[model samples]
Target: MLPRPPRTVQVLALWAACTATSLLILRLGAADTGATPWAGPAPSWGEHLRFWDAGWYERIARQGYPAVLPVDGAGVVQQNAWAFMPLLPLLTGLLTWSGAGFYPLAAVVCLAASAGAAVVLDRWLAPRAGGAASLWAVALVWSSPCAAVLQVPYGESLGLLLVCAGLWLAGRRRFLAALPLVALAALARPVGVPLTGALGLWWLMEEAQARGTVPRAALARLLPGHEVLEARQRRGLLVLVLGAATATAAWPVAAWLVTGRVDAYTATETAWRQGAAPDVLPWLARSATWVGPHLGWLLVLGVLAAGALVLSAPGVRSLGAVPWCWCVSYCLYLLVFFDPTSSVFRLLLPLAPAAWAVGRAGTRVRALLLVAGVVGQLFWVSWVWDRTVQMTWIP
Candidate 1:
């Protein structure tokens, strides 16, 4: 027998286990929402065969976009609602026309696509980090907030797949090929803008590291207690610019098409909800609020403390470039944009690269944090599903 687990075997094991666990959690939660007879009602599946977002998407899928619908006291068109991103409904339509009758079928397609994205992410990060760490990285992503979006007729799964593929390709020094995939991802979710920027940052770092400018002394100063590889950073400015250009190309008419003004999209979003600009104090307070509700306090504290420690740890400062950039970008998007429930962050699910790097200093701690995140997410999802069924609201 091999002395150690082959990376492939480990990855397959991780995938199988995560898939089974997610399904089981979802199945138990779906028991109350009424499942389709074909998918069985005992163990059950999915909360409400026709859920709120699922209904909106299904309507779009089956009948195409209905521009206007009468709201409580006014006629509101979906285009103004922002729930009408085209990609998910488009895919669901294709599947339905091909005889997949939605619900379990759509969920199945979403899970399969998400699994594929996770595997692709594993493949991309394994060489940089190691098999075990890479598996954990992908698992963390698969278990993030609103992950159930993947189990509905949502574009999150496909959008994530495209984003992961783009990140993987970008990592391999294939920026040109990454552009279109990134564009597709952008079309699926606006958060692709920041993720694309992160990928470009990684490419740039790779180029910088390749140039041999990293001083061994400076690296040692950073990671005082650890040994590290000496390297130069890569040239990533061109890649970053290219990715930005491509993303812009995809949303070119956001102004003229959506609101008829150059930046009506922004006004529309702000008019919908109040969001602060990315000022430091406000961001910190807002982040705390968001994290408090979305993440357990212990988990939040631990992640923050861990992040600080890692930045100070040996060989980790440079390692932080990716995640720091991601955190910054995510913050900007979250603050400057609308729809906290939007598909953008879902597309950037490949943050595993940076997550892995951050995990380097304390693997066990990071793993525990990931487990906590998954458990919290499972509970949150189940609770929300239950609440949705009980309440009269359609969100």
Candidate 2:
């Protein structure tokens, strides 16, 4: 058999193909919906990228966030730009300050970031799974459900890019270099809270092993111990663990400082849900309103069990301590904090590495799975993404 092209070339070709097709589908979405006589012609791709949270990011780009939060007569915070972090908009604004249109420039930013993420993801996966499997893994990420988010003016692509890059760096014990990337990743989409947890857990495991604690069998699945770890690497891990914690806390603290309210970020985020009462399990509480308390709780338990099984699968665990820890920590973060919505799937995009587990199937199985993913992407973008005709569902 002939040799494959360079991995970067293969990855970009897949990225371009999937991206162009997704844009074509989004174009179909932009056409006049027959809801109004004057709905007019389809918009440019730049305009097509402006749906959903793009509006909020654009508001942040054009104008700085409000010093004082907006509230209704009842004194509850309203949904506003504070709900978004600044990096994507800040980059868009800086690039467009010279008279470039926001959507067009922002589109370039998102697309390029996505391309970078494809490259970084491939690099991260190759050593563990070999070149061919890793290439297929990149394709799976680009074609997964809600992949259009990468093509739009959103933070997931940029955040994932920096995050994967940071993980790659830190995995080699280059913790100093990983610091800024992790902090920026946090600002991109708030994934840092989970990242911090992952690193803290990893470091704790290493420290425990070094101190002759945590039994080898109990820690067997977690990580390789300190036998190979040097003092410098341990120091770096400690520094990185501290930095990740601070980075994870950065945005919420910034919001607090600017708004003079300790709960500034949390309050703005809840506006999307119209606020819910305090609960030990907010996810269960929200689900109960839809499906009844008993079934809702069963659903919650089912979700947790499903997540645990998926993470423990051989393929997923093979992604190594970094990806596995991040995946597990992120699931915990979602369970405690996330309110169940159709949009919850969008929040799960960072778990794309889990695709590697599924990629380890037989050739025919992989092919069938790819076909299923394409079908899933079609419905996901149609029912969840294309808001012009299908405005009832949130992606």
Name the top lDDT candidate: 2
Candidate 1 residue-wise lDDT, 274-358, digit = tens: 4332333433444456566455455545645765664444433343344444544554444444333323344345344466664
Give me the displacement of residue 267 in model 1, in angstroms: 4.2
Clashes of 1: 16
- Residue-level error in angstroms, candidate 1, position 46: 5.5
Worst 10 residues of 1 by lDDT: 225-234
Q: What ranges in model 2 sit over 4 Å off? A: 1-4, 32-41, 222-228, 277-280, 388-391
Candidate 1's TM-score: 0.68
**How many angstroms is residue 84 displaced in model 1 relative to the true structure, after the best TM-score fit?**
4.4
Q: List candidate 1 segments past 4 Å from native.
A: 2-9, 32-52, 63-84, 143-147, 199-240, 252-255, 258-264, 271-324, 335-350, 358-367, 388-395
